[model samples]
Target: MKLQKVLSALVTVLMVALLVVATSASTSAQEPKQNDGEDQTNLDTQLYLIVATNQSVADEKLPAALDSVVKQLRATLPFKNYRLAATLLNRVKNEGRLDLSWIGAPIISAQSEVSPLTPSFSSFKIRVVKLAKNTAGETVVQMAGFNFGARFPIQTMSVASANAVPVINYENTGLQTDISIREGEPVIVGTLNVGPSGDAIILVVSAKRTSR
Candidate 1:
């Protein structure tokens, strides 16, 4: 009888061990994946902020990178000249968020300007950035809540006296929208009017997939 009882206990222990192993295996299978391609694709995006104006400056020459765009702008825009004001670059992973702010944009200074110009404050953001293949099997970047904003300084009044400080004011320009563009292609997100002069600011965005 003792032997029979011992055999039954052994069988129960074996069943318990099997149940534990099965539970562990099921849990492991249900866990989330790591470093999956769906979430690992990454890219670097370049942002160019160009100022278009009718005012002629000493340096009318723009960046060589924007040669094609300059021609297009000259054809479409009423402004006779264009100059690069700022360029921002950032890298983000698929399904990621990018947010940045700075006080680094060049102040609006035309030719023969004597007073100092205030530094421009700017911000850029993308709430959700993703990399995906399109219908043509080409990779594109999709962005939600893409936004750009800036506060540009303008000289309200020149100093009347040596003891008097220059009166200044600020003008705002920017846009916000969702966008999707193919990799390595530069896109103009939006155009905005800035400062007292009839100058316009054009935003260009270029993206390249750097990793998968």
Candidate 2:
């Protein structure tokens, strides 16, 4: 009887070990496997909008209608005769939806002899409403609105006040209408005026499409 009991205990141990292994194998099979090219197929494309302001200074006093508020800028600004004002980026899809992003705080430098005049409100927000290929086979981007505060310096005082809120509609085409931007590419659309005087706050815009 003692020998029979020992043999039964050994059989139970072997059964338990086999059951554990089967359970582990089942779990492994249920786990999902990743495809080698999955990352490439699921890559996303992004769009970026770069905005820079150019201020033109005249030696004589600016006209009353011409609102002038100048601020010194870093010598390392990208474009000549323009300051690195603001930059914004957005991810675009073909879903026909609008995208909005806030621009960084205005970089207002103190007045200097070199660049003493600048715009009051240096920063604003932009809305990209639509993107499509037109009949001309051009990639056109429709801007829903450009919301910004119109600031004018208080006469004889250093303080500035918000005068008006303006929303403007704009449209532009791709750099090369013949070439489609499947990968990363940049195109300069156009320029806009932010100040009361013409060209006071010149907004230089460039659109870029990139894939990740």
Candidate 3:
């Protein structure tokens, strides 16, 4: 009888041990998995627009902060003379807006529009379509549905006349590109011809990871 009681006690202990083990396994399964040195957090990207011009404009015409960028571009780009026409700083998310405006010589005009486009002011409306990381671990951003507008002078340019103010408008829905930028690192995504007189606009983008 004593031996039988001892065996019963042993069985109870074994059952309790099994129950504890099962509970531990279940709890672990319900817990979130740990990230082993992988970055699972979403990143916030910042975009900086650097508009370089071959012709120098008054310092008062540009934002005060752009003076440094202009100095850097003068040393880097092949242009003998370049000035920072405009600087646009923006942040990135699922969907955002980028509005840019600058006063300079008009470089691009619609073919259907009259010649000698005299618009000296330009503006852009850009939409951020998507932001995702690619398989190669590069953060890619896609932008579309962008439009560029130029204010024309009162006069119009034609084959007979060389002077005219003609407002030019263009839509670029297919303006999309992939950019890989680390925190505080700037990369030039692309360039736009701002003037027929050899002036160009350079777009520099940068990003940094933010806490959720």
lDDT of 1 by residue, 1-212 (tens): 99999999999999999999999999999998785545566889889988888886644677676777778787888987787877888999878999999886344555455333567788999998887788999888888899998887777886878687778787787799999988888877888887778888899888887854
TM-score for each predicted model, relative to the true structure: 0.75, 0.34, 0.42
Model 1: weakest 10-residue lDDT segment is 107-116
In the predicted model 3, the residue pairs found to clash are 107-195, 153-165, 155-164, 155-165, 156-164, 156-165, 157-164
Counting only residues 3 or more apart in sequence or on different chains, how many pairs clash (N, Cα, C under 3 Å) in candidate 2? 5
TM-score of 2: 0.34
lDDT, candidate 3, equals 0.52
Best by TM-score: 1
> In model 2, which range of ten residues has the least summed lDDT?
65-74
Question: Model 2, 1-212: lDDT tens per residue?
Answer: 99999999999999999999999999999999878753232212223222333445323332221122112122333322443344444454432233343323323321342122423333333343344576777765544443433343322223334764333222221221222331233333334433222222333333333345
Identify the runs in model 3 with alpha carbons over 4 angstroms from their true place.
39-45, 51-66, 72-189, 194-199, 207-212
For lDDT, the strongest prediction is 1
After TM-score superposition, what is the CA distance of residue 21 in candidate 3 from its true location, in Å?
Answer: 1.3
Better of 2 and 3 by lDDT: 3
**Which ranges of candidate 1 are over 4 A from the true structure?**
1-38, 59-64, 111-117, 133-138
